[model samples]
Target: MPGTTTLWRPTGPAELDLVAASGWREWPPRLPEQPIFYPVLNVDYAIKIARDWNVPHSGAGFVTEFDVDTDFVSRYPVQQAGGRDILELWVPAEELPEFNRHIVGTIRVTHTFPETA
Candidate 1:
């Protein structure tokens, strides 16, 4: 079966800034307060997966993967909208099964960018 994918819409510029600064070193505080909502997977995971897949980095300090369809965003509408589409990150095949089993339909991953230096 094809893997599932999720669409993530960042809450705001602040959230985007947080992700850019941290590079997924840790989850940002702006993330929604709900266990069912799983914040975006660390960007480092994306970097590692891209390298493992032999994908080239654009030298932008960040990379995104897509078409694997292993992620799913919550259908719950945002209370207040307006944010940037930073990039679509993909989950690897090996990890997809685990994500499916544990996180696929149970949580919504929120994105929050921390303050920059």
Candidate 2:
């Protein structure tokens, strides 16, 4: 079956950077070669993983856009005593099932804080 497009909350700063750096200003980009890491509670660990796997030519890990309106807040709640904000990102249709299979899926995720109170 064809995969459905959906949005998921990224787990850390590294995932966030990957999204930003993807240059996907509009509707996220399709990451073919990239491998996402999921359930990544630690932003630092995510960053380190990105740094370690970031090849000069392959581009960052795979990222894409969701067809439906995502409920990021409901999916990933804020952690660390309100020091951070929780958000979700796009997961490719092709790899959705496999991504779910893994315990801590290797999907890219990022965190962003609100500017205003």
Candidate 3:
């Protein structure tokens, strides 16, 4: 436990598909219209987005858990945007490898949600 580090990313089923296909090796790329990769500071926040926004709008959503290098905490400053606590990293498509470098362990699916409407 002493050497372990963990982080969470909540996403929709489509994104989770990409993650599974990647062997849990990468976070799915943001859409051309999306500008940032937001991994939040807590599971509750992730769940809020997954349920209130993702599942309803996208038909499905997920809550994922993974370990990130401890240094990641220091590398990016925590952000509170739109009144939510998140880590907002400007990870353009070209910079994905650099972003992946900070992720240290398996990206596992911890929870899944089905479309409610």
Worst 10 residues of 1 by lDDT: 59-68
lDDT of 3 by residue, 13-43 (tens): 7788899998998887678877677777677
RMSD of 3: 2.6
**TM-score, per-candidate, Cα-based:** 0.25, 0.26, 0.82
lDDT of each: 0.35, 0.36, 0.73
In each prediction, how many residue pairs overlap at the backbone (N, C-alpha, C within less than 3 A)? Answer: 15, 17, 0
**lDDT for 18 (candidate 3):** 91
Candidate 1's residue-wise lDDT over 1-117, tens digit each? 656554332233343356446553222442234333222334544344333332232212223222223434323232321234223333343443344343333222232223333
Order of all candidates by TM-score, from best down to worst? 3, 2, 1
Per-residue lDDT tens digits of candidate 2, residues 74-103? Answer: 343324432353223334445444444421
Give the number of the best model, judged by TM-score: 3
